[model samples]
Target: MLEAQSRHGRTVLTTLCVLALLACNRPPEIQHDAVFGPSHGAVGDTLWFSARALDPDGDSVGVRVAWGADDTSGWTGFDVPGKLESLSYVWHDDGYRIVTAQARDIRGALSNWSLGRGVSIGVAPVRPEPPIGPGYVQLDREYAFRAVSRDTSGHERRLRYVFDWGRGKLDTAAVSYPSGDTVIHRHTWRTPGTYEVRVKAITDRVGIPSAWSEPRRVLVDSALGSLIWQYVLGAEVHSSPALDEERGLLYVGCDDFRLYAVTTAGGPVWQFVTSGRVRTTPAVAPDGAVVFGSDDETLYCVGPDGLLRWRHGLADKPGPAPALGPGGAVAIGDESGRIHVRAPDAGEWRSYRTGGRVRCGPAFGADGTVYAGSDDRLLYALTPACSLLWSYPATGRIRGSPAIGAGGTVHFGCDDGAFYAVAPDGGFRWRYKAGGDINCSPAIGADGTVYVGSDDRWFYALDSSGRVRWRFKSDGRIKSSPALGDNGEILFGADGGSFCVLNGWGDLMWDYDAGNDIQTGPVVGSDSTVYLAGTDGRLHALRTGCRLATDAPWPMYRHDARRSARAGGPH
Candidate 1:
């Protein structure tokens, strides 16, 4: 029994030895490799760090990562041998950040941290320069606007520029790294006015804006000179004035039975007396002589100095102004249904009789064909020799003179409230029906759109197909013809005593009050000044520049009698 008990004790001892050996061989321990990453980066830059770890017993492992800048990511677990663990952290301030990592075994045994990777985050200090402006820029002209920025932290970076044009326009510009702090931009103003501009700088990386620069006032002046002066006459001036741009002279007839030659400065150059009211706009001869008809049934010619040159008695009162034909021949229409052709010496060349009263001036075609509209509802295409080429019958009395288009299309309006586009050979191209009697003539625009006003108190723009493109309504009947401005603007006066300016799309741009009915159309000067006459006997000059009809001299009625073609304004 003692031998058996000893043997049982030895067996138990052997079992204890086996359990101790198993306890000594515990779960795998983990070892970490050196940590590595970039040393420095800008603030807000993401820093990436990498570390290598392994489990000694080839067991699954977990890693804890810590960024010394008060940032940490939770533990991550992995089972692969010699696996790399990576973590990225963004720095928000300027400071040194150390990244360290430790490994843990499946048995919860943890190793010391690996070598730390140090990263320095920096913020570049900056000062913004004040924005500079041209101070005085001409309207419609592009000028340079500039701003600058300085980096005081000795670090290179990209920057963004924001410019406030003060005209309800904001602009942004960017400069890449290695570019100078100074930046230049360009802008233009559409109208003559005063504005203020400012600018600021922002970091492209962080989108942080610096202080705005000081404000700069910019003065924009009209490229077209402003209103110099105005001249008031004795009676209402219904006559559309003529401008002699070379001589800076302006001529107009008045209801007081007088003709006056005024300088562009609004001073009277000369005055002539007529026996009756001068309703006709005067035509300037090649020799600078003025020829016009009067209600006294007399066609008078006066020198540029306002001296009487000659006078011819007509059978009836002349309704339409005279037109100058090739070789200085003057064509005048009287209510007697006769177109009296006079030579430069004031001698009659021919008097062609029509079926109806001739009430409109003549417009010549490119082929020298004379066009005249009559109360008999006919538009006669006559040769310069007083022979009729063809007569196109209209729906109503053709009181408005014809305007020649670029493609030889003749555009005119009649009392029947229809605007007609007749071919050069007097063939009907198209007809546009308006809301009222078409008393004023039609003006051809640069885009081949026909502009005309009707007694129905509406202004219309018609395409070549006679389709209405756009229309604007006025308060009163529009008897005054519309004029083109240098900037694609439409100018006309309404019987309601309102002169309105419309943009290319028939949008109202501006307006003025004349206090009295405006029977005469406005004329634009070379410098973009608008000259308008009113029944109040006062002529007003306003600075409203346009880009249309710049090369035209009194485009509508009186200035150039050769043809009613208006050259487009500045492009």
Candidate 2:
């Protein structure tokens, strides 16, 4: 009887030990209704669901998720107790789905399932419509483009857009818009070429991207200058162009507040932006640096690579184009009536105050003398050191730059409606009266013939003594200066958009209608091509079959094709 009692006691002791061990360990506890996810998602879209759980014994926990009745994910990697755990799932079919999650401790003790979450899965959004914009565009000018998309699943969703500008440029919208809404974007092209603009859409909730829209072809033109090719700029061009023969590039400024460097092929090479209108003609230095001034009261020097080499601040807006001097020095005049000269090597600058605003570009004599025309109706001469030499008075404002003749005579025009010749020593030589204001600079021929245009609508050829040899009538006022061709022909533009060429005998060789006001003068290229800027915002290149006059003194507006404003002849 004692042996039987011992056996029963052992069984009782084993049962009590098992109950104590079960009481010591606890299963993980999931928070009530803690499952979270988007309420709506597209079919085949990856959706994420999360849940939070806690282990009563401070053990790590892992989460297991179930979608509807058929799909269930294995437990995820363990996370700290009381932390949220997430899993991603893709539903192939559209339906109202219920998602729930459960948690388990490292010891494999599982928790009860959290409250279920419902999601309405549907089809993805449709591809966006192709972008709509101008088929042709001018370089560096911004234009508006638009696109639209819709959710084919009939769901109300916010959509985001992405744009490909075709030139390896891509942009994504920062904010999403409601589905089927037209999205507008602004873009600018810096280089000249053909581009394909395209767009795509993405749904904000489903995070699924739609297919890219059909591409829209856009032909971007440089618009900076053409018969071979024409480039269009952002605004009208009043500034003349300077050619770099070695690089086959042309530099010009525009009222659009930018300096553009374009290839002879009429393609954009690069651009330098300024804060103000760039009305001053660019001057090319011997070392390939381009110098110009802006109405922002500053002068900029850019290198051949379209990078800024340096810039100088001025007290007032520059009134005229910059002039390149010996050893890379530059000279420019300002509305404040100051002539600033910057030394090439030292980068140091010196200024000389004038009696009035200098509206005409300064010219350099063979002897290193600087001559500038001012609104004060005086032509002032100075040395390279900025020291005053002499001043010749005029009846009206001296608006045109001066041209130095082979005989050391200075020729220029005045608002007095007369073209004057001044001796090198500041003495008056003679003046030939015109019908209206003389605002255009003079160009000298090898045989000592002086050519200039007047606001009176006539271009005149004068002998060395200021005697009118002959005159040619134009369709409109002649404000554009004359450039000489290698064949002894004079080429200039008039206000009526007429680009005319005349032989030395004052006979019209030919004329081309530019379809706009030709305010800027023509510059002859080495290959005899002519470049002219107009108020129409195009640089027109004409194959004139005549080269620049190499032997003539002051052949073009600024003395040479480079617009260096230096006398003697082409460098």
- Using TM-score as the measure, the top candidate is 1
TM-score of each: 0.63, 0.60
lDDT of 1 by residue, 1-571 (tens): 1122255454355666666655664443334456767776657767787666677667677776788856677777765647777777777776666778877766666767777777666664354555654454467767666677754445555677888888778888755433255677778788778888888766555454556777788768763334457799878787877766667778888889898888878898878888888888777765678888899999898887888988888889896677766565667788999877654344457778887898887766656677788888888887767787899989999888778777788888999898899887778799988878987777776677888899999999888789998899998999888887644578899996798887656766557777788877677676666777887778777766553363432345432421222222111
Candidate number of the best lDDT: 2
Off by over 4 Å in 1: 1-168, 171-228, 343-348, 547-555, 558-571
- What is the number of backbone collisions in each predicted candidate, taken in the order shown? 11, 6
Minimal lDDT window, size 10, model 2: 1-10
Q: For candidate 1, give the lDDT of residue 50.
A: 68
- In candidate 2 the C-alpha lDDT for residue 427 amounts to 96
Q: What's the CA error at residue 283 for candidate 1, in Å?
A: 1.6
